[model samples]
Target: MSHTVVIKDIRNVTHDVKRIRLEKPSGYSFTPGQATEVAVDRDGWRDEKRPFTFTSLESDSVLEFIIKIYPDHDGVTEQIGQLTEGDSLIIGDPWGTIEYKEEGVFLAGGAGVTPFIAILRDLHNKGEIGNNQLIFSNKTEEDIILKNEFESILGSQFINVITREEPAGDHVFLDGEIGKDFLKSQINDFGQAFYVCGPDAFNESIMDALKELGADPEALVFEE
Candidate 1:
């Protein structure tokens, strides 16, 4: 079954992303890193369902989603970008396989970082962040979402890789794609769990690289 929820608040997260808070239905709940099928509750749009990760913890009063919008797509996300406060959305039951399993490294690309948002927040809130690290890759600095929050939560453990342009302000820049060499240089133990999320190609490449670097296949968590 699906429920219609009203937009309580909505604001920009990055240049092409929106942080939308919605009214939480009584008894509604979801685990960190889980996602639900969501569609705009409007004529001609109610059936355009898409999956989006919850960026808010289960204990939060409202449901939150950090969505990346592509204006040129002329698709669901573009419609989502045009949405305003008080707009409604229809959401289905929560489902995802990217839940946190253990303290380890998280690799995210672009808007794929949404799932890790709540997972990391929950960990930080419970003082269980431990030595968890995050390696986030974006096309440019403006593409990185919640930069300050990640820095505060993970400190130096939060690694940023800018692929398209040189980021100002001393942010770490990667010359090429994340490969075996980079993984070997940054990670000391390949036995720890590695959480990865991104486009299909990115996910495939990272998982392959991790496997080649001696990371256990079972320890690689992602939305498979």
Candidate 2:
């Protein structure tokens, strides 16, 4: 089933990311970390659906999505970036494999952090964010989404890895990609649940490193 919802508000989260809020249909509900297919309500674009994770909690009055736009791709996300308030989007049923199993380390790369937004928010709201950690990697400091919010929610547990431009402050900077050596050095316990979300290459690399470190395969949660 699909619902046509009007955009209630739209704002920029970063240079290329947008935080969009839409009217929530009655009875609409979804778990944290879940996503839904969304299509522009415009004529020819109605069928060009893209999966976007819900950044809003299930109890929120409006549905929200934190989307990263690539204008160079000239794809759905680019069109989404141009959409303004009052625009309508066709949202499909909620579905996703990434969900919170327990307090653990969350590995996210770039835009992949979208799914974890709601999960962390839910935990923070319930005062159950105990010992949860977030290891977010981005090209630069400017590319990180909700940096302040994550820091507030997770405190010193929020880790940032920058691979491109040099970060300004005392943030951890990585010249190369996240590999076994880095993961092993940063994470001590390999027995906890590992929620990983990122580009294909990032996911594969992290999963392989975690498995090699003796992390239980079943405890590694990610979208398959």
Candidate 3:
């Protein structure tokens, strides 16, 4: 099913990342870590639809999405980045299987942390966030999305890795290049389910590393 959501606010989280707040329609329900297909009516790109994860908590009446816009990508993200308040867009019902478990480590790279934001927020509200750890990686400090928000919620349990600007922290090569030693240090149990999201190569590499670290194949979930 499709619904019309009006943009209520827009703010930049980073140079290329924007947070959009939308007016939730009546009778709409969504879980943390879920995503929806969005389409904005614009010339030459009215048919462009893309999946974006919700960043708002489940109890919130409004809907929010964190989007990273690459002017080079010819899709809804670019169009969405150009939108202003009061603009209306069509969005598919919430979908996705990446829901939060009772406890596990969240490994996200770049914008992949969008879905986890909602998950972490819900957990924080319920006092369940203390059991989970988040390891986020980006090319530079400026690339870290929702940095302050994550820190405020997860506190010292969150680990931020900046690969370019400094090497003082937990920096790794690319996602695929994340070593098993580093994975072991961050994740206490290989038996725990691993929730990973990122670009294609990033997801693949992390899943592969999880397997190498003795994680069960069936226990891994990556964004589709």
lDDT of 1 by residue, 23-99 (tens): 99999988999999999998999999999999999999999999999999988899999999999999999997598
Candidate 2 at 187: error in angstroms? 1.0
Q: 7-49 in candidate 3: lDDT tens per residue?
A: 9999999999999999998888889889998889666765678
User: Across residues 18-124, which tens digit of lDDT does each residue of candidate 2 receive?
Assistant: 99999999999999999999999998889999999999999999999999999999888989999999999999999976989997899999999999999999999
TM match of model 1 to true structure:
0.98
In candidate 1, what residue range of length 10 has the lowest lDDT sum?
Answer: 169-178
Clashing pairs in 3: none
Q: CA shift at 205, candidate 3, in angstroms?
A: 1.0
lDDT score of residue 85 within candidate 3: 96
- Worst window of 10 by summed lDDT in candidate 2: 164-173
At residue 113, candidate 2 shows an lDDT of 93
| Candidate 1 local Cα displacement, residue 108, angstroms | 0.3
Q: Give all TM-scores, in the order shown.
A: 0.98, 0.98, 0.92
Q: Considering lDDT, where higher is better, how would the candidates rank from best to worst?
A: 2, 1, 3
lDDT of 3 at 174: 44
Q: Which candidate do you rate higher for lDDT, 1 or 3? A: 1
Candidate 1: misplaced stretches above 4 Å? Answer: none
